[model samples]
Target: MDISIHRPESLSGSLREAWHRAADESPGYANPFLSPEFAAGIGGFRGGARVAVLSEGTEAVGFFPYERTSLGVGRAVGLGLSDCQALVHRPGVTWDAQELLRACGLSVFEFDHLVEEQKPFDRYVTGTFASPVVDLKTGEGGYAQWLRGAYPGLARTTLKKERRLGRDLGEVRFVFDERDPAMLRTLMQWKSAQYRRTSRMDRFARPWIVNVVEHLFRVREEHFTGVLSVVYAGDRPVAAHFGPRSRTVFAAWFTAYDPELSYYSPGLIMHLRMAEAAGREGVRVMDLGRGEKEYKDWLKTRELRVGEGFVSRSHPVATAHRLWRRPVRGLRNTVLAHPRLREPADRLLKTVGALRTSGGTGSGRERSGRADPARTGSDRAGPHAR
Candidate 1:
């Protein structure tokens, strides 16, 4: 296998076409995050972003999008933001993980939420996690009918809340694909506040992240389109979600709601609305990404397996990187796995975050409009997505 590296934008039209074709041909690579457009979007803001094209003779066969630091440590492109990570390739095209890292001059390549079908890097995976997803299906009366049948209890409860919200707040209505930029800003503000309240890093604090999100909101393509779904009560926006949608799949990304209306369960209402609306729009699957949550359990029809690991080319830099990074991830997973440990950890983070916010010195990144470790590392009000 011949590996050639280029900036995401530097990939020629033919190479991009081939990449898209490869993604389209496999269920594993069909994630919107795997789209070349997404890589280019990341490249536009992240100077380190690059794509490695794998070829046989003169034929392009695979694409690996990643970010390489000057020290030679590499990560999957939009690592924290991308819910799905992989070396997207056509069926039957494979390469050795260490060789691939060596070819790209990467001392180490780290990833989380990697698609389970990535066989080439299978051996490197340290652990696997469940990524919840809704297998959207239409019935006789459409999404509403399908939803009622699939999740009757959830449907009954949420619809009841919607009605109560409407009766108390105003007419509850959902816009499947809202195009208003102001509402997007509102979503961010609410999301940022949610982060602050939870004692998490606010992603919107980073200017580049805001710019990238705004840029993505305008992107409309067959392979990937940025979708912002909103739920409103009268003139007030109750909840909103913004994420990318490929031809067949919609990734559940950033979702937030009016915290004051928390009693109404607007977040749950919003996702249900988005799912129904998305199903109506011809989307077949809604990938909820990784991380565990009760809402995910209630909403998902099935689960996709994803892996997390580090791939290295055997070097001092790789060893150093692993030593520094693996412990952090291990600590995080340990806390998340046990509620007794998790509660205290969360309290400590919240205390730190409270101090940071109060002192006007934060994690330096805005909490909203940015992806979290895998799927926005939080047991969300209702949900969180990257």
Candidate 2:
């Protein structure tokens, strides 16, 4: 295998095509987060963004997009923002992680949502988490019939709540692809407040992240399209979600609901509506991403595993990087893995978050989780609903 590194912007058309081809052929790589458009979008803002192209006899066969800090610490591209991470490669191709790192000029490469098929980096993974998905295979009866049969309880409860929402507010309606930019702004604001209220880190507070979301909202592509789905009761927008969709997969990224209407569970209603609409539009999977959440368990057809760890070469910088990062991740994983530990930690963080909110100059932010993949755990809504 021949490895070559280049900035996302500098990549030629051939490289972009190869990147898409790799994603298309790979089983789980069709996620929009792993697409070239997301990489390029992130690359435009993040100067450190780079991709390591793996070639076999002069034909590009793989792409590993990442960002490197001055300290030589590397992370999956849009590490916190992206729900999926991988060295997107064509079938039957593999590379040595250490050599791949050397070619990219990085001492350590860290990732939280690495795809499970990445055997090259499997040894480095400390843990794997469940990433839930909604399988939407439209048939004679279509997605609606599949959902009603699979999640009878959930469907009944959600539909009942939606009906009540309609009665209380107005006639409930949904838009699978909302175009209004104001609705986008409304979602960010609601999400920002949710973050503060829960003591979770507010990602929208970051200027770059804000700009990135806004930029992506306007992008409509074959491999990557920003989807903003909303649920309205008459004229009021009660719930909204913003995420990217590849041709076959719609990643559940940022979702927020109007707290004033929380009594009706608008967020849940929005997701149910989204799944139905997405299926009609040709999306095969709704990637809920990796994290534990009661709602995910209730709604998903099955689970896919995602990994978290650091891939490094045998160097001092690599060792030091791992030493500094692993413990922090370990602490988080421990808390999340156990309900006993997670509860108190959550209370403490909420207390801290409350204090920060009162002060109005909050500095604490979760290191990972771009938008709310789920509203539970830190991201992927642990047990937290809406």
lDDT of 2: 0.81
lDDT of 2 at 302: 91
* TM-score per candidate, chains pooled: 0.91, 0.91
Runs in model 2 deviating more than 4 A are: 139-147, 351-386
Q: How many clashes show up in model 1?
A: 7
- Candidate 1 scores a C-alpha RMSD against the true structure in Å of 4.7
lDDT of each: 0.81, 0.81
* Residue-level lDDT tens digits of model 1 in 1-386: 89999999678999989999999889888889999989998999999999999999999999999999999999999988888899999889878988888888899999987888888788889889888899987666854576688779777766676788899989988898899999999988877876775666678887878988998999998998999889889999988888999999999888877756766767766777777778878999998878766678778889999889999887999999999989988877876777788668766766776675675533333233323221233333221222
Q: What is the Å distance of residue 366 in model 1 from its true position? A: 23
Clashing residue pairs for model 2: 374-380, 374-381, 375-381, 376-381, 376-382, 377-382
